[model samples]
Target chain A: MIPIDYYIIVSILLFSIGSAIVFTRRNILYVLMGIELIFNAANINLVAFGQLDPYLNGQLFSMLIITVAAAESVVALAIVIVLFKKLNTIDLNEITQLKEK
Target chain B: MKLIEIVFFFFAIQLLSSALVILFTRNVVYAAIALMSTLLGVAALFVVAGSDLLAVVQLVVYVGGVLILLLFGVLYTYRDPESYFEKKHVLLSIVTVVCIAGALLFLLSDLPFNYPQLETSPHDATGITKRTGYLWITNNLLVFEVVAVFLLVVLVGAGWIASHVLDKSKKDV
Candidate 1:
């Protein structure tokens, strides 16, 4: 039988990769994918805990997280599209016109 | 090894490989597809963990909705794949991964590892579905309604923004 630690380790690795992508990627879409990855990592933890809890609240919370993630992606992609059209590029490094002086 | 172990091993391999592809790929579209595979593999993991509801929602919301929108956004916005490949920051990414992994290891290392004994009863598929629906309506009804309304608003807003941008671009051209 595979121990639960194995799952936890895999989730940790994924979460770390996602965080790296979020912090280092210049592309807006890649950053959004990173956010999705982070959300998935949280969901994995929720479900793992749900397996132990008798009431299944963790699973319920994961459902809510899924819904919220969907809405967030929709709004974020819309913003990305608008930014792409305006700047002709989606690289975060190039869109620094809003940087504090 | 048992069938469940074999299935889990295969799923874990697929999940990790797809995650690596998503992180390493230069093409945005390919990364999106890799992400879709990764999401599906995670959903399968949820199933293995005995959270069938989470698995279904993960499949429907992440794989079906979020990933599709991401793919469409990439197709509509980016024209050249090579353009995205420029400005590689592999060293920074590796550093970030190492630091975050080290921190997470420190934080989670002391977590208890006692496997709780699951009280097994007859698996009533219908019971889970029925209870989930009841709980959604009774306990989380407000949240459910808010999410539905939020999704509708997002749909309208995105449509409006997309068309407005298209029209403005056309005028400028």
Candidate 2:
């Protein structure tokens, strides 16, 4: 059996990588992918802890998270589509509707 | 030391490497494909951790639904196959990530999981699938129903937002 620390360390590393992706990448798509990585990291944590619980609240929360993430990705992609349609680019920095004239 | 540990390490490596691919790859589609493998690796980890239902959900919802939607976005939004970041925050992000990860690892070093079902099926062990259904109907009925309604609303809203009507009106204005 693997120790819980393995799960913890792995998730932590993933969370960090996801954050790095979000910070470093200008492409909104990459940002979305990073967000997903972060979500999966949390899911791993929840499932790992769920195994120890008889009631399995952690697992239930993980299910909820998966549902929420799916919805979020849909909405975010739709927004990206619209943004591309209107602005013709997906780079976060190049989007400047709110920038001062 | 054990078979499960080896399996766990293998998947951990797979997940991280593929995720790194997403970070490093310039092509949006390659990044998307990497995301798929990273997710599959996560699902494998879920199975290794013993939540079969979650593994299936992760596969079906993430890889099937979100990945497809993302690829469609890619199709619609494909300008050049390649775009590069103008200002590289790579060093800053790396430093920040290292600090954050080191802090988390430090905190985790002391924390321990007292209850371990990792080695054996428990005395009152019931199938997670069965318990999930029961919990939905019994304890978490409100949450389940609300999430259903939320999902419907979010999808409908996204469709409306992306539809031609909004596009037409904005063009007219």
Candidate 3:
């Protein structure tokens, strides 16, 4: 069996990449993709930790996370669609109408 | 080298590099494809880690359902096939990535984790699946039903907002 440390390292790497994409990307859709990556990294951690326990509770939580993530993407993409229709662009920087001028 | 190590390395490399491609790719379509590859790699990792049911869920939900929705969302929003990346804040992203990595390494190294050696104990994959189903019905039933309700709400809410936008667009036309 491979050491769980390696899996943790991979999770951290992917999480950092996801965070970087979220912070730097102006495209709203790509930011959502980055969010998905972060969700995945967390899932990896959950599954890895579940391997340590006999009850497999972590795997159960990871399943819940996956379900929530699917629901989140549906609602978020719908909002993105509405934003694009209203603003005519998916650029986050350009869609600052809610910000105080 | 053991076969398990090789398989682990293969999935890890595929997962990381595909994710990097997703970050760097300027084209939305290509990025979506890369995201699919990354999801597939993660599914493989789930299996390698001995969670076959989660692996299947990862494949079905992330790869099949969400990725398709994302691709449709991408294509629906943009008429200009080429969706360029936001490289204006690359310096900020680099700094953030470094800080996050440092923090993660610091935090990860200090954690005391005890991994029990289950080498002699052979666990059946099918048994795990059966136990998971039993858990869902017995202990985790509430959470399961809540998620179902959440999905229903999301479905209705998404359709509502989408049609609201369409109605306004039609009115303007």
Top TM-score model: 3
Counted clashes in each candidate structure: 0, 0, 0
lDDT of 3 by residue, A27-69 (tens): 8888999999999999999887787666779999999999999
- Residue pair clashes in candidate 3: none
DockQ of 1: 0.57
Write out fnat for all predictions, comma-separated.
0.60, 0.72, 0.71
Q: After superposition, how far is residue B158 of candidate 2 from its true place, in Å?
A: 0.6
Local accuracy of candidate 1 as per-residue lDDT tens digits, B87-133: 55677777887798788888889776676644431222432456667
Q: Write the per-residue lDDT of candidate 2 for residues A5-101, one digit (tens) a residue.
A: 7888889999988988888888888899999999999999998888777778888999999999999999998878877766778989888783322
What fraction of the native alpha-carbon contacts across the interface, defined at 8 angstroms, is recovered by model 3? 0.71
Q: Clashing pairs in model 1? A: none
Question: Runs in model 1 with CA error above 4 Å?
Answer: A98-101, B86-88, B113-127, B165-173
Which of the predicted structures, 1 or 3, would earn the higher TM-score when compared with the native?
3
Model 2 spans with C-alpha error above 4 angstroms: A98-101, B110-118, B121-126, B169-173
Give the TM-score of each candidate.
0.87, 0.91, 0.92
Worst 10 residues of 3 chain A by lDDT: A92-101
Model 1 agreement with the true structure over A1-101: per-residue lDDT tens digits: 34567677778888988988888777889999999989888888777766665556777788888888988888888878777777777888788774222
Docking class of 3: medium
